[model samples]
Target: MTLKSFALAAAMGLLASTAWAETKIGMITTLSGGGAGLGIDVRDGFMLAIAQSGRDDIEVVIEDDQRKPDIAVQLTDKMIQSEKVDILTGIIWSNLAMAVVPAATAQGKFYLSPNAGPSALAGRGCHENYFNVAWQNDNLHEAAGAYANTVGHANSFILAPNYPAGKDALTGYKRFYEGELAGELYTELGQTDYAAEIAQIRASGADSVFFFLPGGMGISFLKQYADSGVDLPVIGPAFSFDQGILQAVGPAALGVVNTSQWNKDLDNPTNAAFVESFAAEYGRLPSLYASQGFDTANLLLSALEVADVSDADAFRDALRAANFDSTRGDFEFGPNHHPVQDIYAREVVQEGDVFTNRLIGVALTDRADAYAADCKM
Candidate 1:
């Protein structure tokens, strides 16, 4: 054989040997304590997709950050340094997302965000290594703010936790609702009791109240809001009153209005199949959180099907180009590394045997986020 043929044969042998090797996916999420609802949903969704795709080339290493940013950094460091994972995925909070994504990207590993899109990463700080399968931090809230304006909800009260996501949510709400301001309250992060705030809310005399709180926070707030004897209409983003909260808040979430990019009620074949299969696998209705997680995994699989994930440049180019069809009806990358999609106004309603928030109105069909123009990336 020629010398060139011998070299080619040796390279092909190495590729064949590593073809069945485990592809480690380091998933850092809030798996313990109060934040487990969303994390569990995301985990189930990812596993469901993996099983359906029938690709055994991946092994997922799931860890719970427990909603602590410090623990997230530590666990992610271990995953990157010790396990030598091929990719990193799943984060439930913005702070944790910000803390871990940079490390993953700096090492030239792909970081897929199933949830949590911090505001800073959407602008000039946007990195090519990071890809969000969820909407931007403010994207859903911005849609809620627009709906507030459309419904003539002027002089509204706003409440959010005193943290990065809380600040971003309120900022997003005010971006489009150009009406008279009533009052804004920033509470401590993870505070369970909303009685004090409920009292304050009663006295604020605002026409409507808008809030952004996820997981346990939403559960507590929705229950308290219903019991507080406040008659005003309550509005929030989907994350604040999602399936996770519905299980906790029970009937308290009824009649609440919120906005989201995807809901199970969407009339599309992709979503229908996903919801049915997810329910059969997990024995529960899938939330948008789960849908996004599944979509993130599917998105990676799509790019991998076309190009080698080990080729950093090729994978990044394909993801940045948004060349895959998302289960959310459409897919397009905005300038800020976020997605431009439809935003639906959903209301908490009981559909058949399950209690859920279904889309009642189309808030913004094919909407672009407010910060896209400001983003220079």
Candidate 2:
């Protein structure tokens, strides 16, 4: 062959190899057991983004964590060491995120969290390779606390599962809530019974009750609370009143106020499209978890389009730029890699047969996380 032809052939071979290179993502989320609904929505929302991207060069590996920290750790090891994924995302629980994110980021794999931002990761332990697309664990509850103060609630009863996220939720609430606590209770993780807690609240003389019980626990508590006929105002973070479980909670959740960063009715083009598309595809309303998952996937996809995941610095920069339109109208990252955005108070209301949240008012505006100063990176 001529010298020119030989040179041309080599160049074409390199181009072909680059075109076929893959960006593998490992998604470990709770897909079964108690928090299955939240995980399923996240997985589905993430997969929808991948499908919409229509890029054959990107590959995704999904696994069910079953809300177990040990199982999530095992999955992280297998994904990073064996499957050789370039990016890791999708963990629903704070404990699971804690188990997997630090270890994965320490090993040089990029982790983009769709849900579960623990305070430990946000503050002193922040890693350069870790980014949380969702708000820091305290953001919503803090907004709820602020709202409680606005509405003249003097004494509030509070309860949460005894875990890292649960503790963070209460701390977040109390950070802004200047009122005295009527009672503070910690329930067991995945506890199905709230009868005892309800009795305590009934005797505590609290003007309002605030609780952070996600997944099935929320459903159980709300149902039992309604049945007990304790007529105090109820408030919580959006986790308990998410669209995935609102229907299950039914009338029990009606008129309960909660704080969240995203709602289906958010009047932004990106959010409107997301809500419509999610409902059409999944046959249900999208929850805050689903919004976080969608945003996380889009953020990754935006970075992927501009920089290859192998180029760590460029990829991280692109992810941090947050170029894509967010379902939450205005979204930016704090120095700690958690979201800085508005948190709104929403009231659970029934629209036809489906239960959902409606925006009442903004609780916090342009809020940065409490841990940004601690993160040097």
Candidate 3:
């Protein structure tokens, strides 16, 4: 062959290789509203992992959903149709996840959930292209229920927002609680005032309270509940009391028991490095949400090393293998594409003015999602 022909052929091959090497990712998370703290942590943790990976081949497009389902749907459409993202991740709220995931997966794009594992996506609606790196919505609450049972809390007041995830949270608590409800209540989404709820809790004579409010709602409730002077013990999912908002919740959150899949003090090399590096980078401790984001990014990077995103089957299998070292140890995906890992009871404690959770004990071991059986996929 002529030298010019050889050079042209080589250039064409290089162009194809470069195109194949690039993996475009889109991140839609709540970054400007009530739940912004959770989304910020997830985005930061995810970016931290991507930076650590030092892979120039991955390009990311990030958008703020504003905690609105309509905005999330719009962003998903733009990302898939215009941005041409190979993967989508970093949604904080279940409502937003529900709006965006099915559509994204239906269009043959991968959706890796760093947070928000609504039971709907875990059960009969499960999609082959959807992977939840976080626990199912019910996992932590179920653990909370188990903890309540262990602590002999026979009659508990339970409350969450009137939403799909909120209902799932209360239902999960009842599944393993083996107790009578003092009162079951649902608050408006993003409701800050808890005066009426506090009054009811005080009047109900309940020995304990289980709440599933996240982000700003949790902070408000904790502060109000403390000021109300109700001596009832509080139990909730770690989302309410995670490191991101613990300082905001202040000492009011102290001694509260919560359930989580990952804690900063999990005693693993990956977790140690993640907690230290995350604190150094962000000037605060990492939350369970942050840990999930970090893990999700690493999971994608791991899959990228072995499989090209263009091959959906290969990429899905690579993700299911879960090759990365998780901050939450013993992490693996269940048949329903949700995590099967241990959930622990965590008690909020103040360590030099910063509130954080200490691992108290394991609430559930090697636990898989309850909806896995319902997942036909």
Candidate 4:
């Protein structure tokens, strides 16, 4: 063989050498503790997609981060060194992502985010190996702000947790609301009791309320708010109204408006198949996180079909091409490798015995993250 041909053969051999070209993925996500529902949904959705694709060449090692940053950091180390995973994904919290993503990518592992798009990573901290299948941290809240104005909320009181995602949540809402601020508050992460906050909301003289609590925090706050006699309309991002926690919140979430990139009722073939397949496999209705997880898996699978992960540049290009159909419809990655898609308003409603969200209308069309401009890559 010629020298050039020999070089090409060696490169191909290296690419094909990964356990006979079987892709290994490491998923570190919160599977236990307070906000476990979100991570469980993400994991189930991703695994369901992989099963449906029938790709035995793809192997996954899943671990529970337990919603702890220190433990997440340790898992990242283990996944990269011990498991020898080619890719890492399934982080749900911005805090956990922040602790894990930078180090993981720096160590040469491609990281796909099914949830948690911290603004820091979207902008200055952005890496070519990092991709977010879910909306940016602020996309839904920015949509919520616009929707709040459309529905004639003039003076709004907003609240979120005191974490990175929480900080992004309130900022996103204020960006487009074009309304007077009646009050703004930040609560503790994983806080279950909101009696103090609800009392403040009642006395804030606000015409409307917006809160960004997710998982159990949302369940506790909504039920408490319902009994507090604070009759103002409540609006939030999909995290607060997702199917995983809505039933737990009971009737407190009904008629509440939330913003999201995907809903089950969205009209499209990709979404239809995903919704149906997810229900059949999981025996439960999927949440927005589930759709994001499914999309993340399909994105990786699409890249795997076109370019081997051993060729990082080629694989990154394939991922950027975003050839897969998303449940969100018309989805694409912005310059920062984050989703650029339509954001819709959804209203919490009851379908038979199950409580869920129904699509109301599009709040933002073809929206990208606010920090995309700051992404130098």
Output the TM-score of candidate 1.
Answer: 0.92
TM-score for each of the candidates: 0.92, 0.94, 0.94, 0.94
What is the per-residue lDDT of model 1 for residues 224-250, given as tens digits with 9 covering 90 to 100? 889988978888999877776686788
Q: Output the lDDT of residue 66, model 3.
A: 96
CA error at residue 218 for candidate 3, angstroms = 1.6
C-alpha lDDT (0 to 100) for residue 128 of candidate 2: 87
lDDT per residue for candidate 4 within 1-377, as digits (tens), equals 99999999999889768576799999999999877888999999999889989999999999999999999999999999988999999999898999999999999899999999999999999999999999889999999999999999999999999977898999999999999999999999889899999898888899999999988889999999999889999999998899988988999888999999999999999999999999998899999999988999999999999999989999999999999988988979999999889999999999999999999999999999888899997
Candidate 3 RMSD to the correct structure? 3.0
RMSD of each: 4.2, 3.7, 3.0, 4.8
- Global lDDT of each candidate: 0.84, 0.91, 0.92, 0.93
What's each prediction's clash count? Answer: 0, 0, 0, 0
Q: Candidate 3's error at 144, in angstroms?
A: 0.3
Please give the distance, in angstroms, between residue 232's alpha carbon in candidate 4 and its true position after superposition: 0.8
lDDT of 2 by residue, 1-377 (tens): 99999999999999767645988899999888867888899988888777777887888999999989999999999999888889999998888888898899999999999988898899999998999998899999999999999999999999999988899999999999999999999999889999999999999999999999987899999999999989999999998899888989999999999999999889999999888888899888888888899999999999988998878999999988988889999888888888899999999999999899999999999988888888887
